[model samples]
Target: MSDLNARVVIIGAGHAGGTLAALLRQYGHTGPITMVGDEPIAPYQRPPLSKAWLKGEADADSLALKPLEFYAGANIDFRPSVKAVKLERSARRVHLSDGSELGYDFLVIATGARAIALPIPGADLQGVLSLRTAADAEALKAQVGPGKKLAVVGGGYIGLEVAASGRALGAEVVVLEREARLLARVACETLSTFFRDVHEQHGVTFELGASVTGFEGANGHITGVSLADGRIVPCDAAVVGVGVIPNDELAVDSGLETARGVVVDLEARTADPHVFAIGDVAHRPMPIYGRMFRMESVPNALEQAKQAACAITGRPAPAGEVPWQWSDQYDLKLQIAGYAFDVDEIVVRGDPKSGKFAVFHLKGDQLQSVEAINAPPEFMMGRQLIGNRKALDKAKLADPTVSMKEVTA
Candidate 1:
């Protein structure tokens, strides 16, 4: 029995699993590390699928998170196109779709997430698509060009980015959101308003407060979108950017505690001692927020995977700083530094009319988070402010009268 090559099996080769594999090597982990994923291609970024990649500015190679040679050089048994069908927790093994079973000393479930399907009539039509993978982006790109009519379902960051990309290609774009306001799920009103103006300035039409109930298609290609209010919109194609659900079926079947996703502690360890979970699949708590939630961001995935790998490989738990998410919409770069939901007040710093502003969401005198649009200094300063539990005077932060560095000084 050679304990020297102790097996470590990691499911899903997304940002979380990929980072865990690389971090294990960095920590001098000399063991058999196997990375498995259902996707045929190597781990690439989902962020660009809605933005630059769709506009033909970024190539597939540019979107690759890590090169193929890097995985080989690090001695990782990378297994793509292999889906983990079942988890045998008691046996310390995972059953694959190909009738093969692999054992692990430490199992990491980074199965990530999948796009939530639109329950509309023509949701499965050929022209109807969901933006989640590289294949989705490539297909959508081919349909976008000059004089095309495109309808984007959902007004979240993903939908907005796609709208911006399609408009850039000289396509007439329309966004359909069920909510009264855009980005209602994640962002505050102040940030959403800023984005609304950005999209409008680019000639992107807003069909806000509208929900898609069905689609008008003849031969599996979407011709128009049918709204819940019986309004029919003529469009060439449709892109669904609703939301995502965590892939937690295997973890839940294995008797691991799961609320929204796999429940993990600060160290990314699940209820089971030998098994751990990370990425968008893990519903971990934030010491700042005092609650547990699944974060569907690349940053969250990498940070949690790094922490989980450290804990499983006998290294100390590297405490995460702050949970952050970023979005690239046209010329503006939206960066959220911390979680700020149900805030008592919203303070705007700088001129949003100029397309450069930051929203400081506050609960009384305490700062909750900063949603910055083209305001890097505020995002950077607000990040430190969130971590240190420091508060800035609302007036000073609002006025472009002072530099952000002065607050730290």
Candidate 2:
């Protein structure tokens, strides 16, 4: 492809899109590159939006992907607040909401995912909030007033983060979930129990095994949540973070195959040769885990972008480490390093009672992954172990007395 003739257009100014822009420039692809963002601000760290950022402990300045000058200097166009409506793939163009079309030789759909909305009545009330964007953080933060009652409508990471933040702000916080346990979507009962205790210690309350069927409002502002079990969880403000739906509408409408997320090959390329998908919208295959998943973490977004950039630039790329994810709640740092779905055995190292341990998951004798709480060293080594297919003795792995370094060796 001729340098000037080949223009790359990426939808979504997020970690995957922004990092792709930088990678393309670093690899000497001197063609025109433009990043379209639906949000007014450029790409920022999303993990913080649920944790320290919500408590006002962190500022927006530290969440940037690249400085304003960095984008301009690299010859990449940054178009903020642009809504991409339609994909004219046959024309190799994208139709924007502003009645303008942009052409591209190669296109990347990194639109990420949107918060799953509350489906019941009174969902659109004024006091109800969802935390997914910068505007949402600012709005939710403003609502977290002193001595106010905060109701978290989901027990997921986002909901817990908001509950923690609300509790820190001296507001009475309660987490309501339809499931019997918290974080059940991704974690086991043991992990969920650990979190329950941690949150309760921070003055957060949880309504487990309960479902909110509807919201109660007064004058178009939410005031309470109606449970399926015939109870009302009353509050001044409600934060809904049930889950996310992948923003694969563009890919789907553009005739690209999408399942769970945009189904892509190991190279992050969609079935369409001219188009690719990454970040939260990509359901890429993992060779190690032998499964397809869409990971929503900073490392995943960056790694996926790097793989996509390599494929476009004619470089060989490995999937790298097995897919891992993490979340921050209060002072506890939960790091997951592998898939636990098929693991036949789980070994607990360190001490769960001590609130610092690593749950070693293995399929027979082969080490699969490790979920650690406040065990950064074990998490780091586990990442390398899963990537390298490191094996360990089952007996030693479960014994906290044996150093993990020695057991792996």
Candidate 3:
């Protein structure tokens, strides 16, 4: 089949899947494109679901990835409220939940991740929620507002962002974390301290190193959380943001190689050349880090979408971008570039007290990664340095007076 005329089938109508279909069309793919999503609505932005949408600052129309009319106008067949139940790899066919089948010239599995549910008791209570979809956000939004109390389990980005939003809506917010510090798994100690202080100043309570034993409820509604420390945190509602598990059952059932996610290469091609995986469902090569990781971020999704589109449309593979992610809590914007693996030193630029600083992670003077808070220059320059594998003088980098360019020199 000609590259542009090949039929494409994409599963999972999240950010990555939706973006891939759009990118394929932009790359001059005139083939038949069909997308199957379990959600009744089309693909929409998920990041905002925990923040603006939860706080009533963003509406459904504003969060949509693209208008419903765009799909029809682009001649893309978007099947919402349908599930891809089975993947017939040998025959390049997919069995759907609606008693239908689809044959594809190329199969793109973009199935994203799902929120990990709390295993404790009372988890099935009426007011306990986890934010992963628009429906989840709406449910959470309705319960968190003035005169309400919200108990958050976990201190990761999602948990912290939700706490911030809950606080903004005048809801009493208490974050319960088993770790001694917030963002223990993903950020440096200094950055963690800064965020913890910020949240605390905003009147959000923190229960660090607190183990949750179970939840207490009455009449099918959660009322409080039982902690190992012999304390009961009272709340009207609760949100659990422990982490996410990739939706890779179809790949596993179809005999595709799998690990933490469906294993794919830089081009997003699985063991089967005709099959490709992208977004949160893909555990692909990270050349810069010299490893494989299932990156759950918008940038990773967009990059992998381009990678898959280029390969399918006969275009040259695009240059690899440094893996980056961002989070917003209150007025702060945290932008991170690259991974801080095996770091030997960390340098802080600017003042955390002034609400502006960048944390630089270095391995023997080489730029490994950067965590910048409200500091765009540091983020941009540090990202470029990381991509180039540049080394720097620690003193110059730490000096607030030194320009980012001069620090490199």
| Candidate 1, RMSD to the unseen true structure | 2.1
> What TM-score would you give candidate 3 relative to the actual structure?
0.98
Between candidates 1 and 2, the lDDT winner: 1
Where's the lowest-lDDT run of ten residues in candidate 2?
A: 1-10
Model 1's TM-score against the true structure: 0.96
| Local distance difference test values of all predictions, in order | 0.86, 0.84, 0.93
Best by TM-score: 3
Lowest summed lDDT over 10 consecutive residues: which window, candidate 1? 1-10
Q: Which is better, 2 or 3, measured by TM-score?
A: 3
Cα lDDT of model 2 by residue, 83-145, tens digit:
789998889999998788899988999999999997899889887899988788888888886
The digit string of per-residue lDDT tens for model 3 on 1-409 reads 1379999999989999999999999999999999999999988999999899998889768988899888989999999999999999999999999999999999999999999987888999999999999999999999998999999999999999999999999999999999999999999899889999999999999999999988999999999999998889999999999899999999999999999899999899999998999999999998887889999999999999999999999999999999999999999999999999889899999999999999999988788899999999999999999998876989999998999997874
- Highest-lDDT candidate: 3
Total backbone collisions for each predicted model: 0, 0, 0
Which regions of candidate 1 are displaced past 4 Å? 1-5, 405-409
Error of 1 at 11 (Å): 0.6
Count residue pairs with overlapping backbones in model 3.
Answer: 0
